[model samples]
Target: MAAWGSTLWLLLHWQVDLKSVLIYLAVLLMMHLYTGLFITAHDAMHGVVAPGNKKLNTFIGTVTAGLFAYNYYGRLYPKHHQHHRHVATDQDPDYHGGNFFLWFLSFARQYITVWQILLMAGTYHLLQHWFPLENIILFWMLPAVLATFQLFYFGTYLPHRGEHEPGNRHRSGTQRRNHVWAFLSCYFFGYHYEHHDKPYLPWWKLYQEKDRLLKENERV
Candidate 1:
């Protein structure tokens, strides 16, 4: 959270050329951190953030979700559970398997609300008074939009894209054991089958679960 906030603050305040390669690096970093914000909220939804304290868990979820473009934790909680309950079906809000663009549209529509738009617009208007418009657009808005694509593609679309094997109860695909790429991509969420199989594991521990699963497969 501090990294995300501080990076955005510094980027927004810095007077640099938009065309600089540094700007591109900053955008990617911000996008990854923005994805982190959502992933943190996701952990909170599963009670991993504050396991014994529901109130604190919910508070963290609310703040993280809100920071990730004004998403409401109350609105997301039920829908996320529904996705787990009815994955890759018509009932799953996250599922729209045919075309990537079409599926992305459906997924976006589920979370994007009027209030979010209003809040973002209001924030943009207010921030422009102190920060450069280009900085706000590139550093703040563009990264968020890109982060959604990163989350949807690596986490959702790829994992649940095609038909599953008869024994694959979760109907999800796991990325190969490449922890570096996994974390860089979407906080190890690319290991989607492990995630579905053990939803309790936090993002940081996912790679450990991936290793365990690999050892089991080898022994079998």
Candidate 2:
């Protein structure tokens, strides 16, 4: 549904000249929708919108990712779950890297890769061309490929590490910075620690939960 809306908007504005610098900015803006879709699918996968219905959640997640040509829930959910249980501990695969400086320096080296993007794009194209619909290649597949690169850079790279609170008791500045990036790029995924603590909360409700939890903790 969201994808359809973005596609329509994109096509409606197709006559706009792509030669100017603003054209590049427009493309960048359109790509943000992909980030939103990814976060939506992530919340849906955790059954945050409707809990206890694993099949329904997985189905929705797969379809959402299919629209974007990426499947983090399918491929990365288990690892994410492990990260949740372990939190900021070294046992958390999501946070198992070196100190903040080293992690920040290796951000591009760690996650972004041309080969991974190409493989994802190629897989999407092959599936669209050989499977039921050829038009999907031009529509969803291509947009997804463009969006994936944006997702990699904005979603994964910057937020890999950072502290959220002062004194480094809970989240590092790097993680907090990541949260801000995720929030801007992917609709509030920057509140990642909150989400990890309560995966069953919807994206819209996450800030509320964080507020509630923080207040409760402060009282303690």
* Number of the top lDDT candidate: 1
lDDT (10s digit) by residue, model 1, range 160-219: 998999999898999999999999999999999999999999999999999999999899
Candidate 2 Cα errors over 4 Å, as ranges: 3-9, 20-22, 88-91, 96-183, 213-220
Q: What local distance difference test score does each model get?
A: 0.94, 0.56
- Compared with the true structure, the alpha-carbon lDDT of candidate 2 equals 0.56
- Which pairs of residues clash in candidate 1, taking residues 3 or more apart in a chain or in different chains? none
Tell me the RMSD of model 1 versus the true structure.
0.8
Model 1 lowest lDDT segment of ten: 14-23
